[model samples]
Target: MARSIKNPKKAKRKNKESKKKGEASSSSSSVPSMPAKVWQPGVDKLEEDEELQCDPSAYNSLHAFHIGWPCLSFDIVRDQLGLIRTEFPHTVYCVAGTQAENASWNYIGMYKLSKISGKRRELVPNKSNGNESEADSDGSSSDEDEDAQDDAQPPVLQLRKVSHQGCVNRIRSMPQSPHICASWADTGHVQVWDFSSHLNALAEMDAEVNTGATNSFSMDPIIKFGGHKDEGFAIDWSPLVPGRLLSGDCKNSIHLWEPLSSGTWKVDATPFLGHKLSVEDLQWSPTEADVFASCSADGTIAIWDTRLQRTPAASIEAHKADVNVISWNRLASCMIASGSDDGTFSIHDLRLLKGDSRVAHFEYHKQPITSVEWSPHETSTLAVSSADNQLTIWDLSLERDEEEEAEFRARLKEQANAPEDLPPQLLFVHQGQKDLKELHWHAQIPGMLLSTAADGFNVLMPSNIENTLPSENP
Candidate 1:
């Protein structure tokens, strides 16, 4: 059962007071108030008179904003935050492509989302159960400071848009050079652009006083290739090799992009043709430059090496339906996550492919999954968005604890009525968005995730999920 946010401030305060009272009273003296019941999204239905209620305790920080035109795809532009940011009052840079009413109205946008203020809520022990066990708690007094920041000034969304020829199907920024981005357009052309000038413009505007305005400009792509017989959605830049690229088309052909010293890319004429159907998504290996992975509409995933062009090194029958998306785990090279058209997502262990490659599978989303991404900082963490209008975060390291659940049920009998089917690995489920298309975790910010949909975009960070990113402590 998906719930919406009502008055987060009020809910936060109320939950805080209740927690204090519960903490004061002994477990035997008085029974603590039960929490809001949890329910599955597609399985549970709200009645006509039943309205959705927001649980403020569920989130640490949440904000929503829109661009004039909805974006079909976007990629976060890396900044100088040193890649493991844990602080707040955060700022983000990204590039997005619009799906406008007319082909000519479409644009590739560069954005600077600033003043996203909030701290990571601290988790306290749950004293209600009399057992010394840790559980998620409501926000502390520091929330008041965050609320003040919100009231004084809301988060800002600033952008500079460049006119494009057609609707963009997908867009990806080079990890090595974020200002350089590759976009696949519906016009059956793949184009690369240098947004250095636009990034500089946004940076300059940041030094000025506040003004609500969007800057627009016209620019041509640095490189344009129309070699694909049909449009495609799959495109990715090699992480290990700067400027190296792979683009796959609906005609089951994938082309390689090799950067030249002259600031242009040389496209190989002989395309890789291992997949028998449309290539839906592509991901380059995080560890090996020549190694990559691709998923297809034929329900198969192929592992390929650029050195051996024509055939895949290994192939697996990954899903029963079209594999729409795949995310290669950078922190754990052996693990890859894939989402399918049949509303299921699975984790594959490449080393175990000869036996049973799939280590984990989920059927949580009832609609087709549009996006799947592994958390850059956490090896066992992942975020997924689906056509069902929901974004979910999962922690693969978690598993069902029957003893803990029994203790929880004994303490809060009514509220602990979560269905037995609820996957323990699922950490959070975010709703209220319409037709959620894609979600990406900020590599700089530990727990924050940005999602795009038909209505607009949402930036959210859940309070309960712990930061399990490997320590950088000296």
Candidate 2:
């Protein structure tokens, strides 16, 4: 949850009163009071009705409908938002709002597969030999006849929602429900909207609001957090863990919350602290519920095991500037990747220990690396976005074989000596008009990459079929 600090004047007033509470309390209790009266019939009934109307179910029904995909047209983009799958080859991408002297609403969009047409194909089931002859005699098709009628269809892409209040900086999907936690700059609040049941489901008309009025169920978030003295920059949900959330603020603090039986949420503990600068991102460990990672402007990344509160399980001072993002390798629990403002990206292996020491370092970048992500379906591949206006995919599997490294280096040298015969680096760059703010690979699809840039453009780069990138091979 996001919140602001109390005003200093108000805090001082309370502090002053507390210091003289004994002297002030006795005299303050003698204030006059009004006598109570019996309630009026009509007036009391109306007030009771108003109170009942404030209930969540009475106020509105949560409905999700498909909004057309957003058009990418913005200038001076500041961030990117995306959803992807590690097992499938698809991605949904959104560009952050832009402010190029004038303010216009920014939008989110999904990538389109060029070669695949947006068409629905009918499915027909096959018949086996036992029922084939009998079914055919009664005008019912045999399994073979049914099988011949089935056709493979490309997946249909749908636009989910459009933000009217501008671009969304951060978004997270809930594990237990089809809900999303979205943080917006316009309101400086995080909204939780139910969207799970809407996926692949048909849309329906929104229920009435005022009875005399027709109301469309707006994506007015069910719960709003923040809008206090501080604004939120990052938000995340515990994967597969219900009702657990974490959000980071500019004051360099992390807030944790859990749901209560009353249907409202409350703080679970004191804010987690360690970073001296604002935290840029937070990620829960893929394998462990109690473990997580946080990167900060203080040029460090710390791994936290919630079970041990005294200190981080591991801290790496691998960057010279703020660590913008950190991603855990879902396929390999012991591996993690981080991108930083110092124009470098680093991958660390927790399993490799050298006589009680750990190996943690970085590979340099030409510009500030704003985002980093490990392939959810592939163990050895990682992706990073940078201010250099390019996104690069890394093959960490290359590090495992000395012969492959030597061969790559030899190819590089040969390329330098002969301009035309050199082998290409596995790293591919997706060019943008401005600095890339963020990059994400699909959670289910291994190769599809989604990127947002400073110029207010979101692009989806599908995995090339010619690129025989290994899933676990890197």
Candidate 3:
């Protein structure tokens, strides 16, 4: 949302009253009260009297659900709606693998969430006749609100689960065929499975059907490969080449999977060995069919081309600590984003990789970054989740505007106070989740994001940022 001040005079008055009271208390007590400031996770330790506060107005819509066990990885399945959808009241399909306490209790869950709707609240209160008006009572409505009514029914979730052999380390959906997905097992095996049956079952369960009752399905992986020497987390499907796949392991081996006419995959026996450490993540180029990228524990990013020999076409020292994840921008093909174990993430322009390619860098997250993804709709936007229990959205195009900052502080100093060191590019910070592991932008819904944490999952769209999604109108 465009920067604006909320309320200045009222906040100043309240602050003055509190300061007076604090001064009176200091005369008798030795302990001094901590001044009010925007709480920064990880950087600021919580006191016994402190508790996290959530602002309901910051989100247009939010929902949280659990499927019994924690899932370390998940993928959003593409729907019939073509990519670049900006419509509201959306429906989504997703598949996730569980990290259960008992390996036998682990399952692969397929989900269908429908009637996902909520009204977008205005970030700035409407001013009329020198009085502030609430967003909900302003009596102004738009088409977006028509689709997302204020009293819209809560989103419905229908789930279908299938038993898996071991804990799934990572999972990815095929870009061309969302129902056909692959998973990396902690048991040192990569398996491909067709979940079309589970999809069909979920699709048949409409609103009238009872979704609270869990349904279990029996199935086996369509194909399994146990060539990797150890368990790994890196896996991705090529967007340019349908059914083409890549998998890397803890033992520093990467395999190329080529689709065959027989419906199975032909993985290269001779692996691509470039990294000196475990491959942590992999991403196929959005524009190139033969080219892909990988990040490793060795703190390097390797660009590999299957057409060439098993060596990396180019390798860059991306981070000081282990490079944990990477995302190739689909709209901006030349730009790539990466997150690292040192709690920092950076954006690099591939065209200048040989020179000074890092265009932007952020050290906001105070813990190891868990996931990073560029928005499918906004070229300059991206989302990141960290072990610090925070998911932050950023817009790289923004820079510090001293004039705007001054106006905001002058008018809304007490309403929405922020640390002076807060980055201007930081759009929103979402918390409340414990041990966030992975997140994905819904391919079919503009601005919608689904994240999986140790507790469960959260589906949300921030009110301040999501309204900026590209529209046909100006």
Instruction: Using lDDT, give the best candidate's number.
Output: 3
Worst 10 contiguous positions by lDDT, candidate 2: 4-13
RMSD of each: 6.2, 26.5, 6.6
Worst 10 residues of 1 by lDDT: 5-14
List, in order, the clash count of every candidate structure. 2, 20, 0
Q: Using alpha carbons, what is the TM-score of model 1?
A: 0.87
C-alpha lDDT of all candidate models, in order: 0.79, 0.47, 0.80
Model 2, range 1-474, lDDT digits (tens) per residue?
211110000000111222232332111334432211212211223232121111111000111112232222211111122332222223232222322221334333222221121111112224457745532342242222223322323333333333335445566555454334444343455555544333322122221111111122235555666633355556677774666677777677777666667654665446678888887788887678887888888987777777777366777675778888888777777877777777777777766522322244444356777778776556766777777665666555533344544453453341112122111223343443365676666453334555655544333332221122334522
- Runs of candidate 3 with Cα error greater than 4 angstroms are 1-37, 81-87, 120-152, 213-215, 467-474
lDDT of 1 by residue, 200-275 (tens): 8877775324443465588889999999999999999999889999999999999999999999999998999999
- C-alpha displacement of 244 in model 2, angstroms? 1.9
> Which is the better candidate, 1 or 3, if ranked by lDDT?
3
* Pairwise TM-score winner, candidates 1 and 3: 1
Cα lDDT of model 3 overall? 0.80
Stretches of model 2 off by over 4 angstroms after superposition: 1-167, 175-178, 184-187, 196-217, 227-229, 260-264, 310-313, 351-364, 399-426, 455-474
